[model samples]
Target: MKKLHHIYIISAFLLSSCSPKISSLITKDYQSLKYDEKVVVLGLNEQQPANAEVLGVVKVRDTGFSTKCNYEIALDKAKLEARKVGGNTIKITRHKKPDLWSTCHRLDATILKI
Candidate 1:
């Protein structure tokens, strides 16, 4: 019984630590830009799956656990910018709950201009 208790505690800690945190793009202000223009994002830590396709604009809401905020944009336009950038990583800013509640995930990406 004592060993089982220890296992449970360890598992709980691991699960809590692995939980995903809210993240947003930290670049040019997303609010001021036009919807049709592509924004550039930098310093993204994770690589988006190669197979993942931008499926139009999505407004994601935070569920407080294993979930995060969302945004909306033109799918084809976003993909075009992503391909032009030549890098899979996009910029994002992380947010926490209670102290950090917001209506939208502020994120945008832009292709480097040659």
Candidate 2:
């Protein structure tokens, strides 16, 4: 009985530890911009030095902009970049004005990692 109980507890702990957390954020935003905009560069860091990596890309809703692009970088990098730019803040910069079909908006953010 004790052995079975120990196995159950270990299994539960492993399951919880393996589960990945799903989080989302809007790295860039363009409000009422007629032309499309492009992001030139992005900087990311962490509050408490930690290694980070780019995960993937996240889709952002169109807010009357030309084109919108979002990226899923490492959480640690995101947090660091965020703190650098503006703690818990998102920064958006436009390189060129929108044309018609698409507007370019770049995402420059950082977040904490595990």
- C-alpha lDDT values of all predictions: 0.37, 0.35
How badly does each model clash, as a count of residue pairs? 6, 20
lDDT of 2 by residue, 4-74 (tens): 99999998876654322223453443232222222223333323234433222322222442222323322
**Between which residue pairs do clashes occur in model 1?**
24-93, 39-109, 39-110, 40-109, 40-110, 41-109
lDDT of 1 by residue, 14-104 (tens): 6754323322222222222343445444334655445543322211233344322333322233334343334232333332223355443
RMSD of each: 13.7, 16.6
lDDT of 1 at 62: 36
C-alpha positional error of residue 25 in candidate 1 after TM-score superposition, expressed in Å: 19
Q: How does candidate 2 score on lDDT?
A: 0.35
TM-score of each: 0.21, 0.21
- Report the error of model 1 at residue 5, Å: 0.2
